[model samples]
Target: MAVLDIKNLNVAYKSRNEKVFAVDNVSLSISEGDSVGIVGESGSGKSTLAMAILRLLSENDTEITGEIDFKGKDLLKMDINEFNKIRWKELAVVFQKSMNALSPIHKIGSQLEDIYRVHEPKIAKQKLKEKILSLFKLVNLSDRVYNLYPHELSGGMLQRVSIALSLIHKPPLLILDEATTALDVVTQGQILSEIQKLEQDIKMTRIMITHDMSVVANSCKKVVVMYAGKIMEVGNVEDVLIKPTHPYTQGLMKSFPTLKGEKKELSGIKGFLPNMSEKNKGCIFAPRCSFVQEVCHKVAPKEFEIKSGHLSACHLHGSEIN
Candidate 1:
């Protein structure tokens, strides 16, 4: 069964003059224990989609339409009080900037204690400490980190703490928005490995938002390719990330350098993203597509099933790519 079902979710930042579309008509269903990665360059609405699901976006300037159904409840329509109860307990997020996410003034253990107490208030102090310490060990943190302030810990350590805190609640759905972006390449790999290890025992669905295809390759089973605020492809990582069907997904794969196999010069997709504030009738990636059809510039393409479990939004299909 699906743990989360998002139907035609549209998120736009509105101003007095115009509305900038960040996510438009995007629909996805995430099943339990699925490790899905949403990959795209900056401004592709990957983070925006995560924020919308978490209800972190400010309603004053941001207009969010459609449903964010989480475990049978509509998160978007849920009351703020009720949603707060569900946020970290059932669904949690670990952001890239770990330093900013944590409290600098308080020691790590105390801060974690406060968070745990909010949701699980009746627990004894000794039991809470034991739980926090156990979580630290799970994320591979040192016992010394409990007394250290946020600034005292290294960036990697801080991120580990953040991960531990998120996992403390044992949330069913964990949305990690660029969680490994700010770390060094080696540190990123270590963190990713740690996350994967956690999965073996956690039994939780994970959504990894990143621009790195390799990250998806290393961690996720399924991949969602986003460009210009829309999903270009969605399928198993082997089908979508390895053998991409959409031109944009193909471009993304080409742009990145591969560590193994035949070494070749990287190819970049030429052309900037279309303005989000302006209205466009065509596929937003048409300007940069190498195999663009004439209709691609004139009409928006609906998602067509490319394989048994793969889908793409392009006039062209996978067979025509070769």
Candidate 2:
């Protein structure tokens, strides 16, 4: 069954006199225990989609439309209080920077305890401490580090702590928004490995939002490629990564280095992303696509089902709409 279902979701931010579209008519469904990766360059709306799923965008200046159904309930229609009850307990996020997420003034254990107490106010202090320690071990952190401050740990260790904290309540859905971006190569691998193990052991659903293809290859079973606030392709990770259907996805794959294959020089996609403030009437990626035709510039293509469990949005793929 699908754990989260989003349909025709649109997000726009008002700037001066214009509304900039950050996400446009995007629809996705994530099944239980599935690890899906949202990949794109900056401003591709990957993070915006993640934030929108949790309703974390600013209410005053941002306009969000369409349905966000989480576990059968429409989160977009929920009251703030109702959503709060589900936020940390059912859905949790580990943001990009661990340093900013952690409290510099509070000890790790105390901060974790505060989060636990907020949800379980009457729990005994000793039991909470034990739970915290166990979570620490689960993320491969030593119990000694639990008493230390954020600055006392390395960036990698701090990230591990952040992961541990997110799993404190064992939320059914955990979103990692560039959670491993700042770590070194080896450290990122270790953390990703641990996360995969945790997902298997706990049956947790994960949404890994990142620009790194290698990260998706390592940790995700499915991949969604985004460009200019729209999803260009989505499918099984091996299918999308190994045999990209969309031009944008192909460009992204070519731009990144691979470990197993014969080494090739990286070639980044050309041209800049279109200004979000302007209305796009045709394919958003037409300007940069090498195979762009007149039709691509004049008409927008709907998502086409390339095969079972695979979808792509591109005129070159023809009109096999899914």
Best by lDDT: 2
Native-to-model Cα distance after best TM-score fit, residue 279 in candidate 1, in Å: 2.2
Each candidate: what lDDT? 0.88, 0.89
For model 2, residues 167-206, the per-residue Cα lDDT tens digits are 8898999999998887788767877787788788888899
Assess candidate 1 and give its lDDT: 0.88
Cα RMSD of all models vs. native, in order, equals 1.4, 2.3
For all predicted structures, in order, the TM-scores are 0.96, 0.95
TM-score of 2: 0.95
Candidate 1 lDDT, tens digit per residue, 196-274? 7666677789999987788899899999989978999999998887778888888888889988999978988898888
Index of the highest-TM-score prediction = 1
